[model samples]
Target: MFNRFWSRFFSSESSDESTTSTKNSKPDDKNSGSETEMTETSNEIDFQLMPTGLKKLLNKVDLSHPPGLAGDICEDLATLEYRALPNLRPAAAMMILSSVARQIENPPYKLNLYVISTALTASGKEAHQNYLKQALMDLGLDSKLHDTPRSDKTIMFDLLYSEGCSIYVLDEGHVLFRTALSSRASTFEKNMADLLLQLKTAKQYRLSGNLKREVQEQLIARLEKADKKKSNTAFQPEDKEKLKNLLELTNECIYDPFVNLISYSVPQNVAFLFSKKEIETGLLGRIIFVRGPSKRAPLRGHDKVVRPSKDISERLKAISTENLPTESLAARTTLHTIKEYLECDENRNHGMYGAIFARGYEQIRVVATLLALESKEIDQSMVIYAFKQFLNSLHECETHLSTQSKTSIEESQKLVELKVREYSERHGSGSFGVIRNNIFKCSAPIRKLENNQKDFLSNTLQKFADLGVLIKVGNNQYLHKSCISAKKLNTAKKQST
Candidate 1:
């Protein structure tokens, strides 16, 4: 019955958009007797003028009431905007919604989304991050927030080892992931990407580190302590149990990690770096990209400083700790909605599109759950609003990428190669160490780095070789042809003098 209602409603909406196309194309009244025959012929030969199913579905949505949590976050962002901060109101709000969804237990689908928000530099990415940090702090979730994107090792060792879930708010994560997938991406970046994929899809991920040495050391220390205690008292069963549990920590090999990654970056630098293959990986599809509204100039003044109110802070604190509805009505609604989304997009026919539809279905359900709040059932209106928001995100990402040209990318690469070659000629010899130092000194020319500069330089130089900027002469040794040209020019000038 629900499907029937939506189908009828959408059909009517599509009909409305398709109205004049058919009427305007119809033949004149003089041929009225043969109108039926002409119409049939046109129907057979003419293209269908109906609005796309997805567009009509999105158009029917009422976005007035976003999920309570998301709405409140947006309001907080507005407060920041009033204070003259670079405002990413929409992006901040969606990220908060994604964070809330991460904490949900036994969700019908994975509620965690790899969210990215893109804005131009000085457009408030930093200020927006600060606002989000303050909001999370108000909710007593400040401990869960991380400034940098963690490697798979750190993620496992720090949060997942003890806590089941964590929310990492990383700045420039678009750079991290994009660089990781680029031609010169480092192993650490690749590992981080791989680990994220594993956690997203699998219920449990295998640990890669060795535990045997640590376990042996712990056992030895415990035995020595027990022997020392032997002189004072008898060995207790509890002591044996304590040792057993300690041993178990090393023996434990699998972990269930629920991590929500909210990343902020510049659109041009990050989003454009993604290739078709990356999108096909299903990882890119999992991301909902929110492009901030552009501001021609930065806002300034003491009058613009709007602090978060006590009421907003208290509300956020209350919601973070409140018990959500136990009923599965919202989850069921989400499942049904996902089914409809997939079915409706059947004619779209592309792997990336299908992946996106699946990911959006999950994201919408997450947003719906955040909106559900204390309500036992998810509202149909809220789910539709969330779905519409996802569509908007998809549109933004597609439009941004579509606007970029291959020539521009090639030109950018050429600039990077020239800068690298120039740096090598000025300061580096053929040795890796000297070349690496040169790369660091001129690192300002590099767009992105993972964790630190050293690894980035190494990976970048390797990429330069791959791009034919340098030829590898020996292990960890590279020679740039430009360096030779510079040397010859210097010798010629000396001879002329």
Candidate 2:
């Protein structure tokens, strides 16, 4: 019965791609600017020359073409009018991986594939995001996914106590990065980054901080929902006791948060947000950056609603989600295979490749995810698939970052400060939030800032206040400092001369 079901699932996925690929296909770009550039860049990487054991494994698996879960998801997402890097499929697979994560215990680290996708505006970044979310929903795992987290403390609490496996998708990941780099980042920002770093490896986390209003509201909502489903809900009396215990233990901590994250950001000025210090410290190293398509496929208007093939729904229903034992010899063998690649000097020297190379075992974790999904032993093929996905993601990152517009961070800062001062002089004093918002809304050389840009502005304004460029008169409010305006001083000098 299991074999029969899986056969149907595979057939459905195959048929779905064979039928719909052309309709939602990427535009053939022989002359487009970004497309030409990307093509030239991709040509530089020799896929046939094996650089890592993972690549060797991948070549062995696909004597002809890439296959398995990642391939199927990529096909399905493409059929849905989304153009993205190959990493989208693996990143989307995280939701499925989360289910399997629940069954594994006491691993060295939790299964967390931290992904950060960067793309140009209107270049299917949003479409890629929608595709991943839809894939989860199709697998009947919508409830496992959450929006951009409100705070770090909230994530810590949810991972500890939330039912089932969880994956939080942050749309404006750059905002979080900016906050981390902020000169005066709120205590909330620092704590959240620290907590995420901890949760990445440690099974348990100590949740401090007095329970905030958000936590209280979430608990009340959970209780209300439990009452409504009293007939079938799994909220037993012990569960209630557990919730009470969890509330009290907020001061102490909780254990085994098997959580993962998927984040998306625009590439504009993102590199500037990270300092050399942050990069070397492994904060940036933890993230896997996937660059979206260099050239967006032209958007086509369609009356028909495009969707993933039925194979996805069938597999989710038919496949057993039992996580295999992590201690098994096969798992150990998989680790050794990945270790060989970790030591490769060729893989180590790639540009800004520290983030990708830092977590060498990430390939093993991803392969484990594949093994769990297939209920099969770790093999060269699975490792290959895992490495190929990372290779594509890494290639995309290098290509995109290399070609990204390089704006001087200092120049950008001066532009923002000038805009803020102008706004303050015209409108009198305003709150930091107000000043930040106004600067972000600029249309000239400043243009519109992304969410992260606005966040950086907020941080910059606070630093300005500290330096006497602005004075903080009230909470979240600031006024320009009594200093001669640069423009005025220039005019005065001209008249004196």
Candidate 3:
């Protein structure tokens, strides 16, 4: 049953790809700039994943090959042997856009994004991110790449010390959320939710006043060294300039701190990560959730890697922070269109999800700004393409994060129901001893229930009894109707035989 749901849910994911695959090989990537198109009225299946507003917005823009730098990047990654996995292609493309966007001067808006990827354990969720990192390192753009920061004050510390942008990768995202739940979490980690919210549109980062002491101490040491060389003379001209600059920076404002956050995790981590608080506070709404394939990739023969073509190499090398591309009129108009549609949730009608769609409006606008700054082409294709990806993320939030998102609670409920029925079948009665002492075959989700486990179980059982599936027979016992019927059928079968 689980496998069937996975197939139906993800059937369209692979339907767009080519069939040239074999067993024991990596995933395939046959998508091109040409369209695997979708229309506004197209309801491909009962489980259509695209949100209504985004789907309607698609009707206004072309759904063919992505235009400009974003499209070129998809092909570039494929050429570099980073073939698109289930949900990896779009994510890698977004990273490429982010890498270039971080370099430009972010005055009108910040292009920073927070991407959250969820997949099965060992399903290779980090494959595309790793591949993109390796490509950037090979291309000399690795200056912006880094692991997570040491502390909150030091979040953009490395970028400040260095002369480039920053993108932090958190490979073990599950551990991150687990720690967020801890009362002893670090100040920086605890502030992650707020940081993500503020940074999305922030134009400056307040310099930590405490950082001044370190700068002051360093300057003092530098002057002392220079004085020792001259023995009673003041510092050298170079030393004086260095000290002066260091002290000035401590007071300087960190404007346009372009930082991107990427994380990978399994489906089980969603509860600990988002929770009711994160959702209500708009943190989860800010994150772009990229879900990997429902089922494992088809096994195919391993192939040897190949060097990227010269055209792709030169294109990647051309990307730099030295200059910003001109924003296209069409792209700008499309962004405004998206803004108008999502703002105040006027036509979106997403209910409680309106806030999230509005946040996605901000995200898409940033992408349009970045792609324009990278491609310099006056086209709405990239803007349309970005909306396409955002639609998928929104659908994921609705299906996985909203309904049936709490696997722990679901597991406990299912276990209690199954055990009650089983016990009634054998002893013709219902008691707490059945589920209470049945921990021998318990799973992780069962043990992860809230503090009031006994009360929760009692409430659940009572709800089932009220529905007629279970009947109260005594002070602490109930009879499962389905189990009794099954037992009677078996007895009748035995007598007939």
**Candidate number of the best lDDT:** 3
Query: Against the hidden true structure, what lDDT does model 3 obtain?
Result: 0.57
- Judging by TM-score, tell me the better candidate of 1 and 3: 3
* Candidate 1 residue-wise lDDT, 1-497, digit = tens: 22233334322332433332221121110101110011121112111222355445456553322545555555555445522222245456655555655555555666666777766677546667777677666666666765565454455544432355667788877666765565676665566677777777566654545424533465668767776786555667676566656455555554446777788877676755444456667776677665553432335333544445677666554554244444356546545744564546441334335556556666776666666653445666566667766755655444444444334445655655676677666655466667666555665655443232346556656777665567654465666756657665455335434
Residues 1-497, candidate 2: write the lDDT tens digits: 22222222221232333433322334321112232133233214333234444433443332112345545655566555444343344456554545545555555456666777665577555655666666567766676777665466667556646552567777877776677557688776666677677666666666444535456556667767767776775878777766676556555545676567777776664665444355555665566655544456566454334445678657655555444433346546655655555546644544345545656566556545554555445544555555555554454444444444233446667887788778877887788878877887763545433442455666777778666677654455666654346675445335434
RMSD of 3: 8.5
By lDDT, the better pick of 2 and 3 is 3
**TM-score of every candidate relative to the true structure:** 0.59, 0.59, 0.65
Ranking by TM-score: 3, 2, 1
Error of 3 at 350 (Å): 5.6
Worst 10 residues of 3 by lDDT: 30-39
Give one digit per residue, the lDDT tens place, for model 3 in 39-128: 222212222333454455564432223456655555554433322343554565666666656666644556677888776566545555
Clashing pairs in 1: 83-304, 83-305, 83-306
- lDDT of every model, 2 decimals: 0.54, 0.55, 0.57
